[model samples]
Target chain A: MAYFDYLPHLVLFTIGTLIGLEISYKWHSEPFVKKKIEPVPLILALIGGGLMIFYAPLGLLFIGFVIGMRPGYGIYESVIGILFALILWVTL
Target chain B: MYYPVNFNLIYILLEIITAFIFGGLLLGLHRKVMARIQGRPGPPIVQHLLHTFKFYIKELSIPNTSSMPLYVAIVLAMDAVWILALIVGPILGGSFLIIIMCYAVHKVAEHGIGLASGSPYTKLGSTRAVLSATAEMPLIAVPALVFFKTDTLLLDGIINYQIVNGSLFTQLPLVALAMFVLVLSKTPYSPFGIVWGKDIVSGYKTEHFGVIRGVMMMGEILAFFALLWCFITIFFGGIITAPLAYMVAMTGITVILAFICALTPMVAPYHAVMIQWIFAILAVVNVLLI
Candidate 1:
């Protein structure tokens, strides 16, 4: 039952991660027809965003990762993710 | 025991003077901090003031390619709208609705200036400005959330509610965070600096110089202070009692924002819009949860 309580946050984290991956892929592969997509940042965003939903402080480190990968993942988007996690922490 | 209407007018005049002085100082301080972060000695704290003074003495030249009347009118109008917005903002305890309207008017002025200038660079900047404004529309949720929590749309009423209860920052940390992010993005140097980023050669002000540019710059600084004041009043009103404390909080926010700006690379316009929508959705969800 406790696991069910965390399901919504987990789902949000998963969705956010997938969206981040898609956006990052599109950003790097733009203007070229067959450029290979980089999956490292995508994987990191997924793992870090999931960790963030369960542990708020980890989101701060995730923010640093997002900032470091400029033009791929937006700092503001990471901020929004962290804020959503914080909201879930307070409410659910 | 109430004074005459003229006394109120006098107070308003004094308030405007204080706002301008401090707004210029804050802009100078922001430049100084940002430069220091980049490992360079920055300009003096009054550099913005000195620049404005120089603009006053410089010769004015309306671009031959520009629509002269529209260009001049929009610049003046932008300054006027910002002045009114600052007056109605939390600094003056006016209605929040009026403040929002003033900001919308300011955007119109921004668009008008860009279109009237007739430069390709300014046009591109204007397009990005429109995109940014669309993305920033979500910021209206800040006041809406406040109204929902306090049952009033007036700045004074919101502050009073916070005093009766505790700080909104403690009770609604998510909303507070969302609002802070919104404010930071709108600040001069954050990633949203796309409107004035190097690609556009100072963006919409590309064709503007001399006195007209000075007026726009003044308006920008004033708008910054008004937004910062509104943020403090809405979130930290319960804890900040004195004017000095308000100044300190504003400086802290500015310094922190400078650090963020110095560290983060500017995001593209599409990414900026996406980020704002994500933030807006999170804020709306948080409000519903509340």
Candidate 2:
């Protein structure tokens, strides 16, 4: 079967990640006001990245990067991002 | 043979409910065991469940320095990962690879919470958590070796192989030893628990309070159950055929772990990492030679 067959799985994963990020951005942002980089546009980028997972292993790496670059970036956060990327690359 | 994806939503729901309820009971039991080891009267065995409910009724407070979104996301994500791991890894006979992936995602939750908190203590905890993850990576070889022996990646397949050929632990004692070491580090109160030790005011959880803290606590209970379930399934044999055996083994291991934790002094993060690395190397050599 082609990797695209797993598109539903990828969509679910992307949706889960976006929901998680949007919740974080909405409730946790300082002043709780409108931000320049709202989470909706970012969700589109995440969907694009998730679709890319079918083309090459680098897709998960991109998704991980986007996740790490979200607000509240830190050293351990980046480390985990890389770890998740590597895991998805190897497993999926 | 791939089964049709029926996706019984009710089964999944029931499984999750049972896991959390039993998981909370196990956590409370662990606390009581630890208290007895320290010569103190412990709270009731249902203390953890009560505490979690108390947090639900309490006001939610977000620390000013914290990233609220990430904080909440980490807790919820951690709980989700554990639930999936338990259901898929052991219950539904999923691949060992998926189990490992779930574990990796769990580490992400841990790292995110510590980093999002913006507390120095949590930062230190996050750094140590990273170090621990690095050290724990080699233990993945345990499953790899199991795959080599069983010629299958599914937990059910491994259990069947044991039923036919003999226990994996007996055949591969060194891998069992390595897994024991990994389990020890994962257990609370161990020297490896510096991330949550008193020295750091509960480490990554220092900034979390009220309902959020409760969610984290629930995640922890579920995580512990997942680990213990994995251990019993992979090392001792399948819990399906031997439920009582698994329970006895779980209780025995918990008490022994608590005793070791009470007796041992907390080790520095560097020291803990070094020790795990040494064990990992030994496991590698064992896998290569045997």
Candidate 3:
């Protein structure tokens, strides 16, 4: 099965990303893209990430966070996740 | 698998309206509880609905600094995304993944809202919203978890899976926890609400007012309704047997989330990002183990 079956959704999401860029361009101080925050690249990254998630739900999103997120994965997400997983695994 | 032929468009339309009315009342109740918890006498439970009404009757107010039309277009686009969510989620019983697509688009609309407003505060809000999306990204693991558990990604299929084997909420609760976190993160004033934090003076919406604000509020109401609807359909599939029961579940969830929102202080920006990422990673590892 082709992943692009959900192409309309991808189009709408892209249009939204473009709209955000236009808004940023209009009001941003530097004229093109903001310098300090670098929203353009960030927006591109979001679009890129969204595309990956759409194309492949099984994508390893955890690896990225696992790398930047020290403490051997994550504290709140990991701890609460493990705690709940254990309780449910044992009880259910 | 959709069995769409059985659904009456008019009947579903009426239910959407019913969901809207009840959603507003429940949100008002959310505020009342939050206020009483904080030791202050809150406005009437109907205050939120009244404000939504007032914003419509009141004149439209665009900021002097904002560029023409883009400000208004952003507001309408915000509503459009949720309206799409309403269609796919509650009306059509579309795939679960599409709802996430709508959420991704909504994030962009939110980011644009701050930038289009032309205020420094609004700019900060836009930046914060984008930054906040980073923390929230881990939640994308949710649909993946559901797909793994149910062996199907369609909303109707998942609901049917629950109806037969019992809810995923009980069978694989980690998914529910991730969803609850997503709901809390998206809730109006929850601890994860960094986009509209007080310190930023209304955050991204600092400059949006009057009809513009009202339109945004309407979109928000729809967004809230759609989120709850999806959550109920996804996790508590048993309740769909009774329409009224389904609504009651929505209200019940709102009340529970409201208490959590009221009690928790706003997370610091960096910490909020860190916590969200942590939640996502946890979800991935747990699901992989499962």
Candidate 4:
């Protein structure tokens, strides 16, 4: 039941991303480049990230936060994230 | 063609109307804020409606430099996408991510139109618009993370979470703050108001006037309400328990936030960067703590 809750959101996110990508490509492409087109990578990134959120369900928020913080990962970031991860891991 | 009786077309139409009205209200508030900052009495709220309504019917004069069909197409697309976002909200029962996607779509559409114009000012505006949008991308992601942690991505779910947990501010205080900043920046509020700020030749609106401008104005209002709706839904909770009360509370908060926009000193781009850094740090800590 809990997993089912996210299924709809995941589907909608994917569809939305695709629509956005198609619109972007349609608007951005010039005449000469019309014949040669490929899948939009930015849209793909969002779709993949969204899918990860759907299946695993847990740790993604923290993971996304961590990934977002990137190479400058600070003490506060590590400590707070680990602590919360432990809390959810133990509780949920 | 019926899955359930959950969908109400009339209600959805009303929601779209409300979004536009709210947008017009923001324009009024914006004028008053600017007036106070500059030490003068600006026009009334109805000023925007009156001006735009008059402009809406006026003849549109296209410069010889203009590409009429492309220009009109872009304007229509921007308007349609914004209104579509409003309509889609209730139809989808206000799916949280879809709301965000609606916003992203609107932004992208605006960028396309701005870039297509080929005017130097419009080009500058489009660049600023894209840069500001780029800055917001990550900030916006923080809320979605909060949604994931709470295990509720629907507007109704987030609202219920607040009603159940007693105020979202208590749990994800950091995220709540970040979202407030996101709202101001994404909406291009003062200080972070680079897109259509006073000093920037109205950014993308530099060349725009008459009905095209009117349609863009309409789109702006609809877009504003959409962002506000998402902000209220995620952080404050959605229509939980008493829908009417929640709506009123959301309106009050939005008004207060608007006032805050009026009063705060416009921060420079570097300042916006520093503020975003602070917000990013807080979001990082928040993710771990949750």
Candidate 5:
């Protein structure tokens, strides 16, 4: 029952995050990688954040923080992901 | 449901004109402050206006290095979206609606411009822009949730909510923190300015010049007004009968926020990321409790 309460948010967060991760991964792996830092994880985080907006803004934000823990891209990505998540939660 | 015209052509024209003046002033003020922080008197507040005008009449430099038509088309499309977002503000029920549309359009337009330019700086801007957009998504959402539950997405809804349930800071202190973080990140100040700032040296706008760049600036200011209007509508009043009270209160708050953006040296991107998580946690806890 508790899980059901959070089901929509979680599903949206996961779907968005997964999409974000894949997009970020692809985006970073492109020839553009040599030109810039990795964007895959951050992109994943954004997708996750946006999805979370329609459900529980807070839940998505929490999920965003967790997904932000992926290694190698540094704090900027995590910060951006968290920020994006929060923005969607607050305003959307 | 019947909808009232909160914003219309007259209102939009007024808002756009105000945005132009206000954005120039803010940019100039920001520049001056940044210069003062670095020990110099920046250009006059009206300087941005002159810069913008110069860009308007300047020859549209069609770089043979790229497809001009596609580039122009993209910029136009982006500008149109942003304009639509801005005009919706006075037409919609309240400030939150304006903020959501404005931010959404701003992000899209920024990304479009970035891709269209295809320069290194522009690419960096585009990348940072995506990163910035990714960061702001959640921050914008949380506040809307509070409004949603109260059965209003307009400025009036927020004020009424405040009048009945008290300010958000009272009902949801944690979410308020999240809101602040969102404001900082979206505004791209010192700590959250990884994608913008002097380090990027023009960031996304680096490759742009003349009218293409001018249009982008116009969009940026419109977005800024949208942001300011949202802030006021949520925290203060949208279209208050007591205009003086609304102006005084909003001006005071806006000034404080502006000062914070100017005086504080930016934190590293790493620190910003850490702070984001902290605030996000707080916001979630607040929401769960609610």
Candidate 6:
């Protein structure tokens, strides 16, 4: 199931968030036709990521979300999402 | 004699629908009450809900200059992110951080949305959205004040702490007041609603019409509801467990928000930012000193 251990939170910071920001920056800055992204992958990423939130470590799901979010909308959202989560951990 | 084991699906679906409808109704109620306060008759409380459905049925189009992928994706992102917020929030009792993150995301997404449209109004709307967001940075103290008192950022932890210690708000009144400013910033026609100010012609969504608009409408409703739910549950404690009690409390807050929006005229954009910053800073200072 879901774990709230420091390892997962750290994974969320170093990998999950970085991947999301990178994908978003690339998606928006590059030409849309260069990648020929389809809605199906985006949709699947959403479905999988959402399901994972309930069943897996949240960090993994967010990383998948960033990868699928090539359109760049969730970039800022995902980044802030991790930050808020970190706020609690840092205090601990 | 027994409940089913697959209640998760039912609960998830129910919460999403409940949040959407309640969020829409709250907006409608706010409009009606605000109109009465301003000495004018208002539309029925279902008007906002009706408007959203209407947007879905109309013709949808994309601008020639728009960033095609982003223009399309932003609407979906708006709806998806909020739905995730709904699940991670009231449905599963996830951390308050996830809920707050979703709220913060909505603001930034608005900035991206405006930029994608290639319309001057949306671009300007995006600019203001960013400014207003930064201006409220001091609201961060609300959480800090909360963490200081409850020693936890998880909603469950906070709620449990409140169960034993009483409402954290009793000792953090200034932080609560600062949060009301945040609540004001999101409501339509609010003094702090600079991003969607009249001069901007619907601000970031000016170019987003038809089905896209409908999705965004649902997203907005969902976000509003989730924010309210989290705000109430976190500060007021277990009142959420009682449906009637939660409804009454939420209605009261909505009415207060509507009155404030109705009575206050929209300020100049920069002035709006300055005022929010001032209040946020005052609240932050209060939290620090305490």
Candidate 3 DockQ vs. native:
0.01
**Model 6 clash pairs?**
none
Q: Write the per-residue lDDT of candidate 2 for residues A1-92, one digit (tens) a residue.
A: 21123333333434334454455555566743334554543553454355455653345334433442333322244344445546666777
Model 4 lDDT tens row, B131-211: 777767777676567766678776666667777777676677788778777777755455677766666677777778888
Q: Where does candidate 2 stray beyond 4 Å?
A: A1-92, B1-7, B238-240
DockQ of each: 0.01, 0.01, 0.01, 0.01, 0.01, 0.01
* TM-score for each candidate, following the candidate numbering: 0.73, 0.71, 0.72, 0.67, 0.64, 0.73
TM-score of 3: 0.72
* Per-residue lDDT of B253 in model 2: 76
Candidate 5 chain A — worst ten consecutive residues by lDDT sum?
A1-10
TM-score of chain A considered alone, across all candidate predictions? 0.36, 0.37, 0.30, 0.32, 0.44, 0.38
- The lDDT ranking, best first, is 6, 1, 3, 2, 4, 5
Query: What lDDT does candidate 6 reach at residue B241?
Result: 47
Give the clashing pairs for model 4.
A81-B288, B191-B266, B191-B267
| Ranking 1 against 4 by TM-score, winner | 1
Which lDDT tens digits does candidate 3 get at residues B139-205?
Answer: 8778888888889888878888888988777766666777888888888789989999999999988
Q: Write the per-residue lDDT of candidate 6 for residues B1-290, one digit (tens) a residue.
A: 12244647755776687667668878877987898788764655556876898998999999999999999897788888899998887666767777677777787789889999999999999999998888766675577778887889887788788888887667677777787788778888899998988888989989999999999999988887777777787778844445546666778999999989998999988898899888887777777788
TM-score of candidate 5 to 2 decimals: 0.64
Against the reference, the lDDT scores of all candidates come to 0.71, 0.68, 0.70, 0.59, 0.58, 0.72
- Estimate the lDDT of model 6: 0.72
Model 2 chain B: worst 10 consecutive residues (lDDT sum): B238-247
- Per-residue lDDT of model 6, residues A18-90, tens digit only: 4554556565785533344345444434543454445444645554444425332443444444454455346
Residue pairs with backbone atoms closer than 3 Å in model 3 (clashes): A77-B278, A77-B279
